[model samples]
Target: MKTSISLNQENLSLIPSDVITPSYDRDKVTTSIVHIGVGNFHRSHEAFYTNELMERYGILDCGICGVGLLDYDRRIYNILKDQDGLYTLITKELDGSLTARVIGSIVEYIFAPENPIAVIEKMANPAIKIISLTITEGGYNLNEATGEFDFSNPVIVEDMKNPMSPKTVFGYLSQALKLRMQRGIPGCTIQSCDNIQGNGDVAKKALTEYIEKTEPELLPWIEENVSFPNSMVDRITPVTVAADIERLKTEFQVEDQWPVVCEPFKQWVIEDQFITGRPEWEKVGAQFVENVIPFENMKLRLLNAGHTVLGMLGALHGYKTIDEAAHDKDFQFFLKAFMNEEVTPTLGNLGNIDLNKYKKSLIDRFQNIYIKDLISRICLESSAKIPIFLLPTIKAQLQGKANITRATFIIAAWCKYNDGVDENGKSYAIEDALSNELIRAAALSHENPIRFLQIRSIFGDLIDNKTFVDAFLSSLKMIREKKIKECVAEINSRLS
Candidate 1:
């Protein structure tokens, strides 16, 4: 038998008292856009924002049809379906306050490979105005060094060959656009909400490059029609666990499948570009900016960069959670000082945003004990994350701004942390794709740290400079000689 949690107008209140009652019409909710990777962050940030907009502004033109490409996601897909696509988002504020709201923006869900043609047809619909993504950093077909599309990947090739809206996110997007073009329907806007810098450009590059290699004729069609809007979306949504569901039901009196619990802080800065049409998300606290570069760069460079510092260090010191990491006085001090003294000074205005206020909020969120975002989650894929998150500050410091000694120390700690052994003297599991290569490269550090730095794929041209190189060497040496605590102190001493 079905899970008995099946929700509909006929069985609206029949939903378990534990289930949330969304004050909206379920029948009129249409699948206007198909989101490719419907993960926790997307559910909390984008879903919550859109639900608020629909309720307040009546912009029902964009009900989301969430999709997952991975087989593991099918279980999650079914759970949401059982709940009538409704879930609760618990926003934990810094002031010991929690707000739980029912999210009903996602109308339906489909696991793509299992229902390939169905996904294609749903996306090919003329009414679908946008195709947004939260497929994470590794999902993109990126050339790590060039930060552009790698056209030669097998998935891209398969997408080029089989072509039922390619199975990968890029393929799905390209194929969906192809169908739209053939049907004479306006193509959907592609918005990426991943942490990768220039996320929209990355999406465009992947889709266009695949089309250029596979079907050259389709390239121009994409350029002239579809829009890939770059965006900066921020919210610290921890990877959900079994207890999160129970907490939502017990505390907020709502049952949620894969419920998203996040810090109160949320941000989505988009480069206002909608091909067919778009939601009035601005009414619901989404900022529409002209350029997303400044916002993206600052957040990645300052907040995320700082998080990596505390994250790796925290994990190395056996601290499991971000709140615990933040409570480390030296770590917290270095983080704040790094942001205020080093990173923030280099950044320009980001959509009239108050940079100081933003930093304060980031710091406050990190202190929320209830959220419990793990350092391990933040520590993954350090190689891809580092160049964008930490390298910019390395470059910025070289430009004669404030002292980036702390930021440079972060870069060094990451190097040693990645290579450094635990008390058992064994290598820590490097979770990144280039883990083996990075470990192998760091081995050459015994010969020369400079040579290790020469890997342009990781650091790019930033490694070439002598000034930053010297700082990196000094910090690395200190980290090796003293402990993590001492290294933090030494960097602080130097910057002071």
Candidate 2:
């Protein structure tokens, strides 16, 4: 029987040699980026790339100093700190192979709830030239209908009152930039790693508006010095549960409190704009392009929208995980047809990307048995996700006069899923910013399907379009009358 070796800086040598440990000296690496929302996605994706750069090219200056803004982040902070800012990254391949490595790009972490000023001071340091974010889609606090920062949010309102001790991401960014300005430190690039389309522009608008309202004097300096470069980042990193941690310990004989488990696919397409220089991430598989918009549109429409469809419709069909749904032949056919027919038409011509191959890769990624990505995780924040990911494709299909049968079915599935009952009549929590409002509307829409489309924030002006309303109603009625799998089979047959 083998005993597990505790993972930490002191025990690096004791860990099994088969597991790839960091080659670069961790002490030699210096912080150059301050990343907010140091969740599993950041660790698995960005940090993994940075770690690879340090190992392969001896780029030690681009070390990451992670900042956790929310109180809940304290747990992750503690886990990473205990391991001396080192963690395990396990990639699960579709063929049932696993690659385990120790990533060491994050040299320090600050739990901002404990010392918000420390986070600000770190960001103000000229050494920290880039402030990246992965605060999720809802973290931006944008008005869904207007596509602008929502100042009416209680948190934003409170942040406006006390900008010195800020609560939200905007508040923290404002204070940090002010400190940097006072010190005459040049502005740093604000990189958004979130899933939102044109994420950098979204961040720019939100941060600029917040500063304009809170500190009018800082607006001119921000406009002159700051840069927000849009980026497209993709990776299927699931939330690490206890089972993942135990698996690392049991299988690999490495004791890790928090280990990130993800599929063996990662892509980051960034706009090549940085104020104070950045890591040569391209060497480590990051793409720096002149414009990330086309890549962004393709990924958001096909991959993200596809995930939403799987989440809503799969849950309705009583599938708990993505792999489970992908295993079902009907669900697989639904995904392929939806992508090939509905989504492909909306995407523009890519230079070299074979869209068909990309769709097939997405299917393979979804079917990775080792990645137990819960459908509920994808289903979370549907109110925010649908508007950003799925709605654009729907609007495009409508404008182009293309067949929207699959898109309409996805919306209907969402509406039905919002009712808080699964296919087996099991009541589950519907997690969303507008859960109550959605549930109320979903209840009414059972009789009048148009009532759900009247959600102006999510549906926008689509409710006024008769064609959209009719298709939505027809799909919703089919879903209500027939089983979810049966409804998918019917849609597939029609498309066939």
Candidate 3:
């Protein structure tokens, strides 16, 4: 165990025999996909699948080349570069079992901010057929109210003025596609791995609108040639901490600089639309469907919405991790009711999906102790998440005139959580783009509970609904006056 070797191409042989490593020759693999925002989720989910295809099925032509746009991505770029684009992935199961694998799917990386031209050149390469993204929901730079690409954003403004020296993802894509057009190479597919509804369509809209405003001549060509396929990806990959790195070194004798720890579950349902071509990912457990809407809806509503519910209430109840909160009986009961009564009614028919079984699996996933998924991580960016994950169900329930007390409580808990203080009076930072605005609103809500609803961008027209208003106020008051468990019990009692 003391002879742990640093993870890299040269040290691959020193890695233990029990751990799975790439089977194909790394040098022979060529890059066909360029993934932006190469964070932990991409490592654990998309890159892992590609690695599977390469090792098991000899799919060497579709290797991934990671591109990092923002300054924060420098950390990832350094880690992957040091390791020769190799890292360990450890999947922790519910029953305390572990699976360790060294993934080498990312053959190369580009820190785009440092050298934008190189990134564009790589994208323009005829060999790279797909450009994918895991840039978070906020990264799309869309106006929430209008759902349009925000040209007024400072970055977009800068990109518009100097298109060749681009900064934003849309800018880079536009320039790269222009290069490809000039070189007479076929267009590549633009795949969005973000969690937004109709993510591919969103990516297409954002990129095309950027082109329309800055370079109108390229818009028509982009529209005709490029295809953006919607995809639904699911995996509970936690933020890798120091403990995870040490755990890999101690247990597996592998010193991965940026190892990712996740639960033993991953699902990717992609629309089968590729311009040049795509890997036979279906051979390695990926689902290629005509439409990805149903699967997207199922995962977003059941898993993501449930995470928000647990996150807000869990943070307020002094629970640090999702598994800790999910293990509590009251938390579990409230979550089930919220999903069945409020969320499920809003969902359309999920083809061949057993709703109850899916719900059960979500609970099991959340309660996986070995994963140590932090509640705070889920609670990050509540402003963006509330609108995307929780609001749709609330809107649907209101239209149907269904009981939405639990759904309303989800919002109320978020409001209270935004106050930057937990039930034990401990202060925590509100990690959100709108943290300042949300904190100011939360302070005002303490004096006038209606103030939080008036944030039109987040609440929209729902603020005027008397039923939702009353329910949210009532829940917020109960959470302020009583313990979270007591508030949950009171809400459940009303349901009974």
For model 1, residues 1-496, the per-residue Cα lDDT tens digits are: 2244333334556555544456777567776777888888889888888888777766777799998898878887888878768776777778766776667899888988788888878888888888888888878877877766776778767776788646787667667777888878877798898888899988887778767776687788888888999998888899888887776655554546677888888888899998887888899899888888998888898779878988877766667799998988888888988888878777865656788787888888888898889887898888888888987777777887457688787777777766756423544577888887777777777568765676778877777677788888987787667778767766667666
After superposing all C-alphas onto the true structure, candidate 2 shows an RMSD in angstroms of 1.2
The TM-score measured for candidate 2 stands at 0.98
lDDT of 2 by residue, 1-496 (tens): 7899989999998889879998789989999999999888999899999999999999899999999988899898999999999999999888878788999999999998888788888988989889999988888888777887788999898888877677788988999899889889999999999989899999998898888888889999988888999999999999888988887888889999888998999999999999778899999999999999999999998889888888888899888998898889998898888888888888887889888888889998988888989999999989988887888888898999988888888899989998888989888899888898899999999777788988888887888888888899899999999999999998888888
Tell me the TM-score of each prediction against the true structure.
0.93, 0.98, 0.98
**Superior candidate under TM-score, 1 versus 2:** 2
- Model 2 clash pairs? none
Clashing pairs in 3: none
Error of 1 at 47 (Å): 1.2
**How many angstroms is residue 92 displaced in model 1 relative to the true structure, after the best TM-score fit?**
2.1
Ranking by lDDT: 3, 2, 1
Query: Which consecutive 10 residues in model 2 have the weakest lDDT in total?
Result: 158-167
Per-residue lDDT, model 3, residue 419, is 83
